[model samples]
Target: MELTVLGDNAAQNSAGGGCSAGSCGSTDHQVSHLPDHIREKVENHPCYSEKAHHYFARMHVAVAPACNIQCHYCNRKYDCANESRPGVVSEVLTPAQAVKKTMVVAANIPQMTVLGIAGPGDPLANPEKTFETFRELSEKAPDIKLCVSTNGLALPDAVEELAKHNIDHVTITINCVDPEVGAKIYPWIFWNNRRIKGVKAAKILIEQQQKGLEMLVARGILVKVNSVLIPGVNDEHLKEVSRIVKAKGAFLHNVMPLIAEAEHGTFYGVMGQRGPSPEELSELQDACAGDMNMMRHCRQCRADAVGMLGEDRGDEFTMDKIETMEIDYEEAMVKRARVHAAIAETLAADHAKVSAPVMTVAAGTRPVQMAVATSGSGVINQHFGHAKEFLVYEASPNGVRFIGHRKTDQYCIGDDTCGEKESSLTTTIRALEGCEAVLCSKIGFEPWDLLEAAGIQPNGEHAMESIEEAVAAVYLEMAKAGKLEQAVITAAA
Candidate 1:
């Protein structure tokens, strides 16, 4: 694969005086000059921001189910429906199935902002499946963020592939920078079609991981290093790994504890290896916290995990349930647009005497279009991410009328593939161009930001069953708040 090492001169003049730690420096003046694709890395990614975590949610699709390395701590199974760990998924989904499930999840869980390809196995080991899912998502759900976690054996060869897909976040499991320490953690690695074990495998894995880190950081991709804390095995060495990755421009370091449940069937558990105590884990995190940002809130989610951290909604949108629903590919571009355009014309003739709403729903008083996230009921009952289509209506003194509906691809499919001219969210925003307000039972930070950026009001509140009733209630609330008049004055000014 051909690799492009960004020129150092560009970095010297780039944001934050050279993109320290693969993050935009204090000044985004330089970043503003970057292409739109590059500027989008940090917007609503929950793992990258503490604030985003509270408001934004993320999910992982278990499309890749193969591995090139064997760690004593790993024992992946695909048959279990309730196991909640990295290698356990209820079912293995094809790229297409994964995309479908992601769409449904995103529509139902609007707060979901990032889509990752974590695994029942190494994502890079099953590169075809991983990239195929990514390619499909790029074309379908361009607004969502893409991320991957790897064991680092194939990272050097896969870094360019990640960039090609516009994937900006990468997590590499690096328990130690020392090969001797690594020997205790990873038992064997498949290299060049041969099984390499002991210190040789450790050394090779370490070299590739470091090289991949340097290359990723140079390309301005955010990197997070994950270190598993196994009591008496590389636990004391993670601090040094933290120092190494941080020096190589890692954005964050996550020190996770080994899950060594004997009944779970992992090699480590079979060997009776013990996981670190809470105190041990906390001490190590603190020791390395000064060197690099330490991620304290990791739940070690399953491959098919969904919803916010600590809460798993994977069972709700399983393949069996997803197959029961129907989706229209051209729902927004054709049906919704046609209906919306006609209704808009009628509303215009009826409300000509009324001054047009001064601004989108935020300013209030004027008759502006409103979009609601619903599950086909005229009621706002679905979360922002779960709505397959948005029902658009005109709200004014004349009352609310069915305008049209805009269709959105499953957002959790993955981020758009690289070099796409427009994102799915951008397209959705354009479809709702004349709309002033968006209503949903729940809203995520990313969608909220996108709507707000387009100058539309995002109303994250529940509404009455009937569309007219909901609009009337919302309008009355806006009037009582004394916001509509202010919006009119602002618009006139």
Candidate 2:
């Protein structure tokens, strides 16, 4: 829990004086830096563009239940409603059922602009079901952006078919380019109608992944490379993975931490393998971000995730529920067009506003961490007592970069007694241990006083303001008041 200061001269230069390289900032600023074609693809994609996540939503349908390879970190589970990781879905569906559910979701949730098929299993492994869902959706819900995630063993073979269905965004999980390191992660692969094990299997998977990446890039498909940082296994090796994928025309790199909880029942989890700490993950991302756009807002969403990132509405649209709900997709598409247009107009206006002031820290000023309570849309609009989680960001001379989120119990339950409120507030304060400030729409005086006692400042002045701007404003205010220098001294003591 040491403070990792970002936005130094090097980071600012690499990030073009905006946010950290490939991290959060104003949507207009981030998009303007990309090539015209790439910008068009990511401008409204919630997962691809950090800024757009505030206003957009993405969902995945679990139609592909057959995987070709085995990863120690992955445990595909069906009928699991409590777990929120990848490869877990409540119920598997047919292509027709997937399309019906998607239309219902889109009609009800206008913010949903992207539909991805990242499965309880690899999409390409079950070609017919995956493509059938894509083909039908492409013909029916043409307005929704189509995306798929794969392990890439079958990608080269599926590329031609993928293009026919108009899939523009693809995510390939390329953990390692070296088969030696890969052998430790993947145990086996079902290739050529046989089970290939150990290093041989790893080699084939890597070759297929690299080949598939090249082919997808050649076809003008936007590719996002996802690597899981296994603490002792591929943690140090992922730097090489990032460089290799970026050289092959990958548009973005997402270095996600391994999820190795023992209860998940994965090989790594049961064997006591550990995931990276938040600080460790952030440092690795900073290292790999020298010239690559690193995605920092990914939620590692489930195969059947719905609604905005960090919030799931899958339960509301189960197969049984879809059976009863009526959907008017034609009218829904019209409304979706209007909603997208308004979002575009708002982003244009936001882009026109003067950019947030870029400050330079004096030699000894330490970076500070701040927590923001937002209900998505990149604005600090959630009330302090009502928030179940707070998105944490680090502010320094370099810029504001989202690090991760901390979960806590909501403090203001209407029926809570005084002792219960105090306990909840205590839990919240403990959850925000490293943050120097909390930014929310509103906070009660009692919690504010307690936060100050714990050396965390409480600020509600930036309600509804962009999170990055408000973070910068708070940092500048603290610096001008000499609180930053005092903080450094206080920490040293």
Which is the leading candidate under TM-score?
2
Which residue pairs overlap in candidate 2's backbone? 7-398, 54-377
lDDT of 1 by residue, 1-493 (tens): 1112111124433433211221211111222333455434643455654323434568999898899988888876424453456788878899999998877777666666789998879999999999999998888877668899998889989989999998989999888889898898888999999999999999999998999888898888888788899989887788788877877777678888887766567788778999876547656775665565566556677888887654578888889999986665344224433543454354334234332222233433565567777643235766776665576665654344443345453223343331234566776776566666778888889988998998888887655354445655676666666655543434544
Candidate 1 regions off by >4 Å?
1-40, 77-79, 328-493
Clashes of each: 14, 2
- TM-score quality measure for candidate 1: 0.60
Judged by whole-model lDDT over C-alpha atoms, candidate 2 comes out at 0.84
Alpha-carbon lDDT of model 1: 0.68
CA lDDT, every model vs. true structure: 0.68, 0.84
lDDT of 1 at 125: 92
What range of 10 consecutive residues in model 1 has the weakest lDDT sum?
18-27
What are the per-residue Cα lDDT tens digits for candidate 2 across 241-293?
A: 98788878887888998877666678998899988877788888878776566
